[model samples]
Target chain A: MPIHEKSLIRPENIIRHESMNLQGVDVSGDWSTFIGSRTITDYNEDMQDEIAALPGGEYIHRCWQCGSCTNTCTVNAIEARFNPRYWIYLIRIGLEEELLRDKDILWQCVSCNKCTYTCPRDVVPEGVMKATAHWLELKGHTPDSPSTIFDREFSNQIFATGKVEEGRVLRRFFASTGQALRQPWLESMVIGLVSRLPVKMLLRLGLSAVLRPKTRKWSKSRAAITDYLQQQGRAERRALHLSAGEGTHV
Target chain B: MTHKEPTGDYNGFGPGWKATGLTPAEARRATDWVEAKIDRRALLVNKDRVEDIRERMWELEKDGEIVVHRIGDQHEPVVARTLYGWEKKIPTNSLWHHKSCGQCGNIPGYPSSILWLMNKFGIRYLDETDQTSCTAWNYHGSGIGNVVSLAAIFLRNFHQAYVSAQAQGLPVGTYYPLVHCGTSFGNYKEMRIYLMHSAELREQVRKILGKLGRLVDGKLLIPEEIVHYSEWLHVMRHRIREHQVVDCGNLRATIHPACHVYKMVPEDVIYDDTVMDGNRVAVSTGLMQTLGAQVIDYSTWYDCCGFGFRHIIGEREFTRSFAIDRKIKVAVDEARSDVMIGHDTGCITTLDKNQWIGRAVDKVYELPVMADCQFAALACGAHPYKLAQLHWHASPFETLLEKLGIDWQQAKAEFESYLKDVADGRFETLYDPKRAITSGPGFVRQQGDQAA
Candidate 1:
């Protein structure tokens, strides 16, 4: 696994001073890029097993230290902190505290599958990233990411109505996220679209908002899907030893 | 001798279509058996159980019972360049248009260009109302969706397409689904493999489908192969030139292959360089090359469009930063591309909307972003504003359209005239962004739009 020249150390982890005398030795300046010592005693030995129980985390044991996932990761290319291989390693070694340090940014995985595509060992690091994210929320290491909130909102709409209206989803996501619907960029986008969109087309889009498009006689299908979803939620929670319908705060 | 004269002729096809392998009932029984012995939790955790299920899936696929597609040995670029010569997977004439949520909402022209091109080519297609958003957006962005629920929705949508084709007197296998969104294209393909691989999942999905009355003749209607619409365009590049209304000989296109389409399904993402004069890119770039456009490659060509769907609507900073820093800057500095063409709606939206914000930071990368179909439509002589919907895009497209010989001034005037007739809500959208700027970065509120 050829790790790139880019070091995995975060700025916060770097311990430095303008000038320092470490035990009477001048161990400061450019040569003294000392990393802070990490104290880790809180280890969840079952962390890997718990994540493995979740959908995407099953292939964790297969990773043979291949850094291919991070090398090819789309998100990793931009935000170097979002490394799949490093996170997978942390999960495997049961470094729960260390893993938690990166939890907030973990859910940013775009599901690109480059990790899965590049993994020679079939570790499917993409799935592991997803499972780890799900794992964090279930074990109460982190609160639900905005990604999850958006997912829940969008899924609920689909379960209720057979399909989603884009306008409805966008507006509902903004509202639920407690953000202003009048985002400057978003407004500029809508304004430009409204200016040119044929009146008939605009009306059609507006009308869908009023009478949301749905599959005819879809109640049975919706009921079936919703029922399965609830069962899954409970089972996943049960795997992590949490009560159904409960988060850490709750 | 008389007994030999009467030969048996029971060709298995049509209304009583029994391809092979386990029937729906038998598959259900096998599922019940698996659940009784080992629950799905074990399957998710235990590699032995996972392997056990994959064996059964292989059996079904081998016997031609449950037709599923594997990327085989090829990546998307290879498949795109090679498959058109023989692979029956990429359907040209008849297709089922699976609508995209983002494209239909934000870039209306995406779907319009696709439909417009299909009609121009006399390609018979079905755009049934029953086909829904792949729901992958919800799944990936929020993690609200589980495998079972997503599978059920996938089956429900594709069943609608299948039934629609049946009612139209077309053969069962005539119209393969041409997915509009990269997310749906990738998600459905994954779901197909999942369902085939696990009998437990198959059984669960079967019960759900049965409860919903979506089972096609009491059997799961799995297509032999799933393909993205871009593949269709790439396969039909030869025919597209025959119907080309405008010559785009001088234009240069740099493609932004949607990650969801290729990166997720790397092997299945068509890969054929020879098809485009040795240029290795997705269908968009290949299609452009066929229309006499020079398709260029640049660094960060494989980058995500920064939609991070949830991030775009919720965490704006990440989307903005990634677009300018990783995607657009490379496209401009390295490729020096005339236009940045993308296939997926999320990609197009991210690229099209964020370029202006990039300029605010004094970024030099401001290529006009558009969906591949919109680009194709423009090359085929479609109007920039009316057909291609360039007016909706934030990127500067007047120069690009002019280079292609489109009357940008007349189109802008038409757009302006329509802008004058808007009563309230639409007109109200234009004012606040400037107001936000004047108010500075912190809690800028408009007259009615209060900052939350």
Candidate 2:
């Protein structure tokens, strides 16, 4: 019941024979080869619609599979899997299982809009990629991306005060994203800057940090914008099938 | 929307009626000038609004009695009437200066350079504290800001410009709304189109602003057209060259036309290849060409510097990689550029800061990246370290300055000693970097060789 000599080797393209006598020739260099096949079973059919429901993703249906977006993508040249065309195909056909394989890298779209500029059909693949990233977080597939955290803090300052003070935004962004304030590159940039800046200018910059930059008489406009954004948030949530008040205050 | 005179009611005056001293005739004239200044096609919803407005502007010019300055295309050469019987689109009188958060915060040299050139040209500009940052950065970066808030801010800044001009006894449109940032220039253009295109958006914004006491004569006042400061530099390029104090003879300049300036509204972007004997393409390129620089064209001229808003702060990896791979690498390897002129702050910062990391990582290519105004300041003989502030930028320009026959080391040491004197209170507190040096370049060259 056992081929005794052949059992010594692992069946990974190996051939073994204790004794071989054939009528013509012993012609077995490779035998016992192992092959594997895969089947995709977890297709979530509503994937495209969910991404499209987010802002910047409404034009996903316009892609023509020309691969222009991927070819022109600034990130794609450096990374192999950051292909917008492949993801759009996986998305359009509801290959949710396949899409999840690239989950860790989906939010890395740099938003250069080169893809958007090159897309003949106006697919706006940069926007689609952003929306896709937003969808991933909303659906609990990934945690808040560093980009999301940075954008949230930046937007918050603008909402509170009609202007964004650069120093304030940088500090808050670094804090929220768990990054050190004294990053080597950032410190180097500041050192170069302050080395040449006059003392009066330094005093002025320090004053802006203490006083903070803002628009005059921004109360009414700020209140209106807050209401409008809240309404937009509720609507976005409704489309995603989540509770209206599920997330933290944006 | 029809252009009808305000018959008997004066209801059209809205909140503007509160201005105490104006008689009926004076008010009517002001209203007519305001209405006449507007590009009617800008207010109308249409597929071909830009060209349509241009065509209609010609028709109005033919029929009307006032020999008015055409509101848009102020940067084009044809507006100057072939150099005689002209209006200075680049204003020589005092104009209000709108500050940019990005310019003032990230690249302090940008504003200072413009001020230096203005002093050189005898052009007067006012930096007003009553103005505010345009706030377009947040709106475009994240979609958190609604149309209403942006509209309110736009109205607020332009209204301040108009009111200040009037207080100085100049017309409402006299100061010309010189936008300092490319993003604000483009964002305001987009908002203008949106405000004209959607009645619902406009009414919502109007109501919101009216409550905040921003409605002028009960109407949102839109500027004739937004003019970027880079455009002003382009218009005066010839004057700058003929009067140039320093010769940038051996330099080659390549321009990175900030995407926000060229790509946002492609049709409205100034200059064409055919405009200057198949040479001029953008304001930066045009101005550089006029300065006798050997301007080079590279393959990645159209690529963004990867400022990508949040990508700079959050995705530092992509920002740095793209800055080197897409932009600086092409400029250095392909064009062999001496200096790169970028119009926007983010693009300049992205290019200027990331080159150090590029060298650190063994990706070794180099070029000094700076604002177009900074280059203009340098060419007009502003002090390299003090006024041009090359010491603050990451991309070193000492080699380029040495090529221009200016002593970079001496400039640095002199400025350093100046700082020490100020620290010791041995010199005057008010230091002016743009004060002209009496010695010629040859004399400076001799002094530089001796110092070295």
Candidate 3:
């Protein structure tokens, strides 16, 4: 039987003969086309277990390959290569090589939860995507994505002050991510906002930046959260078989 | 039955299979099962298979494992049905406002509009400074924060909401929380399920809550219902419509249902038969319809605003591209939408702020975006600049204001003078400024304060 979905078969895997003859009958070009068979040997047998150890990846075992996640994915709508269903299949089968092929785009999962809403098997594919992205960063298969950097900056502010000042988050994120704060669109957006000259809003933004809005009496909560996250970080590292100090850059 | 000739062509199948000798309506009726198979309503009908966390929460509370914050008569509870036909009590009065950090920081108008609406209805509420963000955006964007931390924050905020009214000589449960962010609403619901299902998570969170003095009766506090402010607007649409001073009948509006609000823990979201045939998640649409606006349907109504948590801050090009191409462009070209209304902070920010960037790529779809509460407030004659704060929005809302017959020039002038007044330390507030600080260092007990 022929491969019905030709897109699944890579171009290099298709072998077509330009000139051939079989038993005095011409069997050339399209007639003699063949699919190249390749064996995958670099399978990490513990890939599924390692992913399931993460918070969002807990339900990866429940996926029944329904493809609803990919079909309803917000990112997959624009970027065809960001397929959650395909990645989930690769992870389940321990096909690490194939999974790494699309590692860079994994962090682009928007967490829209459309897939989780549509999943009949309660797979929560959105969480699996997050876990896989985290796994990639932790295992050093990929660098920390901009998304991860932004998350760290945002989360750190909340953990510290018990509230996030948006201006602080944006400035810290952009600075940490090594991006300029003066993008054309950003400048235009600020100009547009300033054109109206809502002085109270401007003063509020300045005041919040200077005297960052915080949850009052947040010292106890901050201390508790910091301790809890440290404990979780150690546990996650243990699950991934990384050293206690490994993957601490995040 | 009258037989009609087949109009469309079919290939590969035999002529016998090509034509069913049935009318188009009959064919549609015959294949209605296919539509029903994909319908969200039908999918939710199998609710028995999916666990209702509220039942387990009640069980846990009964077993002394947790304390459920009940919505009492003081809250003026109005019961609404969820997607699975489950009952959810939405408190319309004596509410504790859970403000979104993003809204307060970015779109100040979003929460201000909500508060303005509540004030219009003379609803008793507390807009205090005690609550923290749900912190789910960072979790979703970066995956650094775990469920344990999220659950702790969830309980901590609810505990504060539970006890916030005591500063004003009221009992502990006088105020029920009305979450103002879609992200928090969804995250709290998911966290509630996690806390209920896993005793270990509850125990872990309870310890943190105890340390912060946030526990109620030495147990973690959980809200009876994680209610969104839009849900409050939805249930009060009839009464809100009664106060409509501006004619919004001529405006065509499109609602971008926040994914977190509807898609995450979808069973808890409100669905009304009167709104879009109960097909869409019916908060923004319901309010818009009740305000006498033409709620137009667009193709990409189901798409995310492309805030993407991280995408907005890190990879904003993707956010702008998706917001313009998938959402704004379609709404303008297809639906001819005058304004696009959304409920979530991120969605409004993404859709509103990103429109200006489209000019860089020549995709200039200039659709104004604002929250449903902002639109509702506008319909009720709230000042666009003073209350709704439309000037902060990056989108072209001036056209929308003109179309609504609102005088932007006069409003801008009035807002400019108001800003001068603000500069001189004289300003108007929706509620008393002293009520904002319920506890901590800056809090000074009012004359009516009583021990709880």
The per-model lDDT (C-alpha) reads: 0.72, 0.71, 0.86
Give candidate 2 regions above 4 Å deviation. Answer: A1-250, B1-93, B166-174, B272-280, B424-452
Better of 2 and 3 by lDDT: 3
Docking class of 1: incorrect
- Name the weakest run of 10 consecutive residues (lDDT summed) in model 2 chain A: A28-37
lDDT of 1 by residue, B11-127 (tens): 322233334456679979987997787533334442332232334555775665454323332212123332222233466766667888888789988887888888787766666
DockQ of each: 0.01, 0.01, 0.01
Q: Is candidate 1 or candidate 2 better by lDDT?
A: 1
Candidate 2's residue-wise lDDT over A1-250, tens digit each?
1323444433542323334433343423221111111345467778888788888989998888999999999999999989999999999888986787788899999999999999999999999999888887887778888888888888888888889889988898899888899999989999999999999999999999999999889889899999998897887777777796564436
TM-score of chain A of each: 0.82, 0.82, 0.84
Candidate 2 lDDT by residue in tens digits, B335-439: 999999988888898899877655334566769989988888888887887787887788778888988878888888999998898788866411232211212
Model 3, runs deviating above 4 Å: A1-250, B1-44
List the candidate 1 regions with Cα displacement exceeding 4 Å.
A1-250, B1-88, B166-174, B275-279, B414-452
